[model samples]
Target: MWRIFSFPLSQIHPAVLALQLHLPNKHMVRFREDDIMSNIVDRERDKRTMLTAFFLKNKADETKPKYLYKDFPKHYTWNGATRTWTPRILKPQRGRIVSANPAEGERYYLRLLLSNVKGPTSFEDLCTVNGVTYATFRKAALEIGLIENDDSLSQCLTEASLFQFPNALRRLFATIMIFCEPGDIRKLWNEHFNAMSEDHQLYCQSVERVQNMVLTDIRAILQSMGKNLTDFDLPNLTEEDLQYGIHREVQEEYGIVVEAEDLCAKDELNSDQKLIFDEIMTHVDNDRPGVFFIDGPGGTGKTFLYKALLAQVRSRGLIALATASSGAAANNMPGGRTAHSRFKIPICVDNNSVCNIKKQSGTAELIRSSKLIIWDEASMAKRQAIEAVDRTLQDIIGVTLPFGGKIMVMGGDFRQVLPVIKRGTRAQIVDSSLRMSPLWSITKKMRLTINMRALNDPWYCGFLLRVGDGTEQSIEGSYIRIPDNMTIPCTDRQNSITELINAVFPSLQNNVHSSDYIISRAILTTKNDSVDEINDKMIDMFQGEEKVYYSFDEAEDDHHNYYPTEFLNSLTVSGLPPHKLRLKIGCPIILLRNIDPSHGLCNGTRLICRGFQRNVIDAEIVVGQHTGKRVFLPRIPLCLSEDDMFPFKLKRKQFPIRLSFAMTINKAQGQTIPNVGVFLPDSVFSHGQLYVALSRGISRKNTKVLVHPAKDFKQPGVYTSNVVYREVLLDG
Candidate 1:
């Protein structure tokens, strides 16, 4: 009879000690464990029986490895003395290399090594051994491939059951590994660790754990990222650490340097400008807080006076904060930024809103140090935005005085563009202006009558003032006739479009590719539809390979009802690109998003397309201080929240650029171009639309009008209607 014995104890389950199997007449039978162990093995057949039983007990009976008793040596052979079988050895597989390039390998290796970096000395030594600067180390770590393509530290730690470094250092460096802004991180580390004394560095390296070194870097990084550092329970850094960070932030933000020679000489100020300048300087000399609103039409040197004031205060070593309502206007001012960006004002402001500023914030400290605050284009800002800054100022300076004891100088032409209130009535629009604010009661009013752009063409400038004031005679139903010299008439729609295009884009055959030439002149339209029509027409005229781009449009969420794709493609709105946007290599495009203001990718910035990729467009800036600088713009998702326009939340992914051949009048505001052609295919829809459009050209000779005769006009002439809210002109 055959009996079972254990083959090897290590590979056997503990359940085998209590189990036994029996077979009789080739039929399997069950027996007790004592019966199987007590019987000693005597033959090869019995050894095979023991191995088969062991394998069957561990897994399923039918799926067990089948082998004849004589064929057991082909797989596993049992040792007569040791009672154990030796398994066949297998070959090890080679791993595929993720990075074969030496540079890429170094980048991966550096990231892995830095992931365990603990102290300043360790980090410094790592950089030394690598023969790379701290900036280079940061750049290597920040390379997208290093983190995404390589094995993750977390995955490795999980597999190894312990991190490569101490737990505290591991966790801290893990966060640094994921930091997106490498330049900001590098700057933070340089500012903190590099400036530390040798004794303090030693103490952090030897005495305290890695958390202390990591905490210091994180605090500086958070502060630079515009986060309130007070929220974190961090250890107190040195006074220099606190002060240098604030100073660096402020310097980077408001640090405008105007060459002393670039400033307009004192003798260059006209009589009207001199009067306003003298009054402003008197308030500055007295060191008394005052709120003054300087009103002037477009091209009347409001920006010139603003720059002069900035230069004067900055030359005197006094803090003067210059900000504008629009990015274009802000770019023209030395050391200027948008008021909302500078003051941390909420984007969507209401009556109860206040600036998002804390008493101990860097912004508050900058304001406290400032002796004057100059907000240009004040009339264009919503009253709520202005009041928000006022409330925050009062809270920070600990004074109820206007603007918190800081002299406030505001300037803008109300006749140009007032506060934009979407779908608002005339009353709603007029009430949103800065003049309607509660603080307007204590303001001093100053007016400028001279138009610097039209100094040699006073008659044309006077006509513009009349057009802005609505004093110009209405030809029929709020329409006015365009002068022959300032307009080119056409007998047909086709002829009219051709004539207008030729007049604005003269010599297009020679300069279509020139960025300077393209931006020197642009056609203005009152509506976005007309702008698109003109842009498509102009792109057809440009000589280059045109690349067409289509956006991915969809509902924000797909829950219950599914909207048709065809219906989404049919929708159009302002402040958004069309479904199909076409561009040539040399075509100029305006940015729609403020992606990187430091790199001049702000809204309203004009760039010339240099090249195109699948997801991004390479372009060179042709406007503002960053002119000739090349930048890459990627396609981003944008959503419009106008419930009045769409039934559901709609998102479109497209490049943040639009053709610059023509733009809406609302977009043309705060811009001064060399030449402008107002294409009045449709009349102005709201107040100040006509003023903003007609005032863009630098001079009357460079400006022209091509209008389609107003509907129902009995008079035989082109007509233009001016929009003005007289209530905004009222002074408290």
Candidate 2:
């Protein structure tokens, strides 16, 4: 380099480097004067992009295409003219926290240890405790309390055995043994043997025969997971009781029972619902790749129609995946799961993205095998998530067709919250929704007009439509008038939060234990600060002794510990529980994460706190299909996503829950609250927020608005900002 500098310092052209310019060695970049390589790559990419965009935009020209798609580079490539590596691919960085499932065996233990341990060099370091090292990763994880014992496994069974049949319990036991990585299999079987073998015990005369039947059933379940009973610590099946195993679909279609009521739902569908039900059913019946979107507002029987369609397909022994964008909506239907959990959609997505589901994995098989997929609240999901599914299906099924030629039935109202873009504008939010997706043009559109909740009051229904459509006359910059019946004036003695809570949860002290009273009522606000203010005061007024749970927070990969404990604890984020979560024994709370959607533990799920322990929280599902079901929640290690606007990844280990007395408007989508109180400390900021908050209630009598203007408390009457991106409501 010195010899070249001495020979011709100013004469040599900057773009003289060969392919070695990409090497990160001691040599400086050759093209220092200008980014000639980048410019070359950009020009090439623009040309290729324009050629394709031109063809797509002007297909009517009927001219022969000059360039094929394969001519473009897939990723960074070598440019012959510039003699530098060209960046051709716009690779999308998918922000997803990769957590190991219990079924992954050693890797799961390692992940568990990693969540707690720091600065480990090798597997031996993780397995080592003091001077001695454990034989297995499981022993190591248990040694340091990184992974708890079989309590979760036992509770899972205890919860399942309440309504599940004996055979199902045994199957669950087998699944737990195989996938859950339970430390003591023999102990679990011994504890639940009676329930697992109850059916066989009734018929079999001898005790040995019942035990043998139970073990035989478990053996069959174990075989389905590609494991033998001998792999576990359970007793060997009796030769006489040993039998064949039945195959199960990856998505568990066989696990669902076709009840008489579910079957009768098809016949009871309303005329509007029947039309959608018939169209989707026909496509499934004929084995066609049909894409349909059922457009409807809240309380318009969308969930009712979804259930009917799911039952129809499941009744025919076909696999129907019922998924929703929000967990609240998912919990309303039978065999429902959140769309993200079902599809493995990336947490942070971009234009170029794909589903994280592996081709050989069970999830892939489920997608390929499923005859129907009903994605509820589709309007709320990001266009990239929808596109990711399309790309994944096309790749995995080896069929270039949309969604791998599967029938995808998505239903939602565009009037509600659209796809959330972090700090996104109106245009950004609208552009992120399915309305802008390429698939929207080809997808069949259906509408549901009859408002089942407000059908009696046509005026109220019309008013809601006007609010959502942004058609209501504005008082001041999108501020709309609140119906006098629904407005609650804030007074000096009674604060807005207290008044709002009182309206929603009447006789709170008396009805603390009543799930019906709590589940049907909630206070909706436009911001988290307002929600927190309401929750703090409400919890203080609540009867039971306050239970304060503090989160363990730290910045991951910060070896120097630049972020201190105090700073970490103070960081509050959306969709994450606060640093200090205070609760009472009977106070209703909402899940901040999807712990187990199948068991009614999901984000936005309402629960009544039954008991509290140092390591776990005992709660009861107070809403949706699993009402009154008890569940255990452990302190899980959760990290804020890459999109949380933090330089370093923030990890917080805490129970995924928050006080549900008040929640933001976005979280209230798809829920039917009988009594809702909207608190507006300021005007609603985002699109459809005002409409969603106001429309959550069943009627105006139960719905109340507590508007506390920041500067002007003396406004003529209660009036808050109603943000509606009317362009999104357009059919186009």
Candidate 3:
């Protein structure tokens, strides 16, 4: 059924299929076939004879093929259209082909035949057929002109086995090769090159560039091995070299550029404030030493402009220091220190120390070191105090003038209270003498006219702003509001106050306002029948918190004098004395005899707590630092004038020694809280005390006050009636 081609067959071994064909006119072709059938029996026999001879010669080497030829192809097909002929090129399709002494040309033909075969083959198959090592087969292919002599074979092999290696090993190999022979191996790329599109080619180029850069860096690293390098000595390279080197390389390949810039610029202020701040900055830039005063009523934005100026100075790399009269006020501004604490000025005690010039040198050194100094609450700072500070600066920095510390900014309103001092007439005279100096006269003064009060109620803002200003008209109506439920018996006033507090500040019952609530007990001066009983009750009331006491006699300093301890001892022998007891700052007591208020002696008036004093004998109580006076209260009431009503009746302690008391007027100087309940009793109406108390209400929405129901108590004067108040309310 089939037409068999008549051709001379070559007999080759099953394992070594090597046959070379000789065409007409020395045009040679090679193929290896072990299963081809020949129609001529004689030719088949000749094939068998050639294969046996080849096998016999190679039988000694076990690693090589046992025989070179066993079966060979005897048939062939010719294609006239292609002008070429096809032959079976693999074993089992033709008779084994024999090659007793294969020439280089014959070997090339055999390789071409092997490469053209349809089935898969291994390195061992090639070795068995060619009778050589795997490496030998590769070299022989190059030597016989079957494949290129360059590293194309190696590159192809690497690419084929790339996925077979571990990731780390592959990376290491790539690094080594990229660095060692970058240019020499560029042309020997494998299937990855043939498969890439135009876009991928660009990507590959970027990858190549990064690889080259890495190679260069590796060379540098090798040269610098074991050498020490500091951060300052390192090269200042661009971020492109630090991050995404491949991305940077890709961008370079695509001709893309990115630019980065630094951010450093000043911010603009509000329109009106801008003009004022700009002028200040101009003066500071010129290095002109002048006192710039920013005086405003409580609500005006003087502090905002001050901060803007500080910012401008900092932007120019200049230093500015801010200081205030007290620690509380110092904390209001950034980087602020208390003026007295910063200068180490001793607190004013007596007339001698108030005008003293011996402590000036140390203060001057601090002033010389600073460029700009801002003193807040300047109104509270006394003229004598300012003079002492100025003298100190003059002694150290040698300026001898008000602007001796360079640029100075003082901010305050003079409507507030003046400084407290002993020997009032002498202190005033000394203070006046310092203000007369010519150097103190020429500081530039700026007044803030615009009121930017943060209160929603206009009346409240107006009232606070006009407190110490004499020109402003007083609002006449009583601001105190006594709730309907507060009309309880006089004995229940404490319970009513407690109930009112709980209702007004419901959140304060928890932790929110815990620190703000403080209870103070009235001190008992007379050792009467009720004294021991009241002290026991007071001790029970102040059980958990700190209790402070003021003793009457030196002997009372012993534990036996304390009423709480006495009561507790009577009840139980092992009972402990109250542990949280501390002494109050100011406590009032009558002296055994009459003493003058002006002669540095405590008479009947209130004794303020200046602070404590120490001496060798013992630490004695210092009553008022302002007047340089001291006194201790006694358990027995001291009889004053015989004509005085109830001569034996104990006087109320002048200074409340139990706890600190900030009056309604003192509390009104600063911020307004969310809710405030004021107790305005009839006793608080004397000498504009009502006015001060009413102004302390601060806000209509947040403030509530309690007052007496009696119409007679509303009279004006020191005790003014409701007549002028009603008229003022109508006008408003």
Flag the better candidate by TM-score, 1 or 2.
2
Clash number for each model: 2, 0, 35
In candidate 1, which residue ranges exceed 4 Å CA deviation?
A: 1-247, 641-644, 730-732
Alpha-carbon error at 177 in model 1, in Å?
14
Top candidate, metric lDDT: 2
The list of candidate 3 runs beyond 4 A from truth reads: 1-275, 349-364, 422-440, 471-496, 499-504, 512-674, 677-698, 706-732
lDDT of 2 by residue, 1-732 (tens): 222122221222222221111233413333334445567445444442322232332343335332222232333344556444344566522211233335545544544554444334344655787677987767876766444444766766666666546765665576456434577888888888887877887788888877777776666556444467788887775565322332334535657776677788888878998898888888887898989999988888998888888888888888899899999999988888888887888888889988887888767777777899999999999999999989999998999888889999999998888888888877888889898999998899999989999987888899998998888877657777888888888775256566777777888889877777877888998888878888898888888887766676668787764664545766778877897889888888999876556667778898898876545567788888888777656566677665448888887877789999888999999998988998887877888888899899988888898887644534676677788887877463
What does candidate 1 score on TM?
Answer: 0.67
TM-score of each: 0.67, 0.69, 0.39
Model 1 per-residue lDDT at 126: 40
**RMSD (Cα, Å) of model 2:** 20.1
List model 1 lDDT by residue over 411-501, tens digit each: 8887877888888898898889887788888999888888888888888898888878877887545777676687868569768877888
Model 2 misplaced stretches (Cα beyond 4 Å)? 1-251, 557-561, 710-715
